[model samples]
Target: MSDEPLVRTVRPGVRVGVDVGSARVGVAASDPTATFAHPVRTLARDEQHGTDLTELVTLVEELAAVEVVVGLPLLLSGQEGEAARIARDYAVALAARVGTVTVRLVDERLTTVDAHRRLRDSGVPGRGQRKVVDQAAAVLILQTALDTEARSGKPPGEPVTTGGRRKKERRR
Candidate 1:
């Protein structure tokens, strides 16, 4: 028999992952037990009016998500670029809107690339992959976060607590 250990749920509540792109934002949700992450839907980015954030708030309340993991697109060398800055700002705004729910930023170094490779390997043609690639990437990001949390026995990623000690941890 295989020797892989079964992954146990660390914090028993739903978690959501978000992949914010130029035009579309991909969303994913974990089960109540946080054992599996699955794609929910793609939303058009509304940076001008923040309609996307409103929808996200509704989605979070509806799913009763305990945490929201926003993908921070860090470079391979671990430097923050424009994309990372955008993600950080978005996470802050999301945290402001979500009230007591936690919003965290996890480094998303190669999630998009890995998602593309996985889709191609799974026989999903290139033409159809673009439509759903963001969602797939969100799934990868959330699954990785969940696994890390379970293994480390702590919540994964930097908690985006604006005006709090955890937010100050961003410097570290």
Candidate 2:
């Protein structure tokens, strides 16, 4: 594992973002400079439990990611639901499997909606878009994390912003 900081510093290597779902897993990756996030690939969920996670870990390793960000789907009321719990559990397991890489969760409210809108705006056919929705959502999640880090002066892996817009930093 690289000695790079996980949360704030834009280290010189790839950082991975994941949108985990029951049916599919969307993956995105950012450049080391943290300037852009590009959709990588989506993996179909394995019928056998735990198999998909093992695959996910391999994918992360292949990307040579310094940090892993998993999307946590919180309800609009900001409460954890079954999906959130599952995502968190997956994150814990993924962290253990990856070893040495920082695995973090970022609130992923509205990411799917945003991704759908983006695809529609881009003229992607609805039927074709379904295949890649998870990948697009993963990109959105990663982009949001990067934007939050930039605005809040927090490191990339740190949880700085809440569900809403970033709060104004108080003047010293």
Q: What's each prediction's TM-score? A: 0.90, 0.81
Residue 31, model 1: lDDT of: 95
Can you write out model 1's per-residue Cα lDDT over 32-107, one digit (the tens) per residue? 8888999998888999999999999999999988889999999989999999999999999999888788889998
On the 0 to 100 scale, the lDDT of residue 108 in model 2 is: 96
lDDT of 2 by residue, 1-172 (tens): 9796655534445678899888998999998776578998898877477787788789878887777788999999999999988877777777767766677789999898899999999999999888989999999988888777765666544332332433232221
Provide the RMSD of all predictions against the true structure, rounded to 1 decimal.
Answer: 4.2, 9.2
Error of 2 at 68 (Å): 0.5
True-structure RMSD for candidate 2: 9.2
Clashes of each: 0, 5
Total backbone collisions, model 1: 0
Of the candidates shown, which would achieve the greatest lDDT relative to the real structure? Answer: 1
How big is the positional error of residue 81 in model 2, measured in Å on the Cα after superposition? 0.8
Local lDDT at 150 for model 2: 63
For candidate 2, list the clashing residue pairs, or say none: 7-155, 7-156, 7-157, 8-155, 8-156
Instruction: State residue 103's C-alpha deviation in candidate 1, in Å.
Output: 0.4
